[model samples]
Target: APLGISNRDFLQQRKVIFDFPTKGVTYMHFKSIEHPEKPLVKGIVRAETIISGYIIEQIQDDPPITQLTVISQNDIKGLIPKYLVNLASGKAPKQWIGNLINGC
Candidate 1:
């Protein structure tokens, strides 16, 4: 992250690990660890939660297709509403996939 740990919005993630479990498959894992501080906030208080997830990318060679699958749990721990998280989470993967496709 360009802003390092103190990002403007949320705390920048510390690490991302990439693994190749098979010949044509790649797995990316990310998780929010136990930070020494409570979550930061701008207007509303943000709480750190157990945000863990993995994304899988599998490439098929016959017709040349890339399959992407993302699974995550991002339940915030403060007074933040569930609906807000749901909305943001729903939109994030689509944007990622779109960007990846466009880049390729």
Candidate 2:
């Protein structure tokens, strides 16, 4: 299996692991999750943002990429980097703060 664990095991181990923002909470300068290979766009989180909900969805049955979904305000579904996302807490890293502030 891609994930090394069987599907049944993966599902059994699955838990709400990340500190997901509440359905409507706005995250400032939210990065795009859809395209990892391409440059990321700095997105502003607003009340009107159309996030379907944060979820760790299974992309591949084998060697699964730890991808998370981020629905845009325009209702477009995008993928987020699982590594950057703090599964333990929803806190942004210090480096991300600088990037967000400087628009780096």
Q: Against the true structure, what is each candidate's TM-score?
A: 0.55, 0.19
Minimal lDDT window, size 10, model 1: 1-10
lDDT of model 2, residue 61: 57
Residue pairs with clashing backbones, model 2: 2-62, 2-63, 3-63, 33-79, 34-79, 50-73
lDDT of 2 at 7: 20
lDDT of 1 by residue, 29-58 (tens): 555554578455565434343554455554
RMSD of each: 6.6, 19.0
Model 2 residue 73 lDDT score: 30
lDDT of each model, Cα atoms only? 0.55, 0.34
What are the clash counts of all predictions, listed in order? 0, 6
Q: Deviation in angstroms for 75 in model 1?
A: 1.9
| Clash pairs, model 1 backbone | none
lDDT by residue for model 2 (1-104), tens: 12322221100111243333544333332332433344333452212223333344444657865444443332222343454333412442344345645993
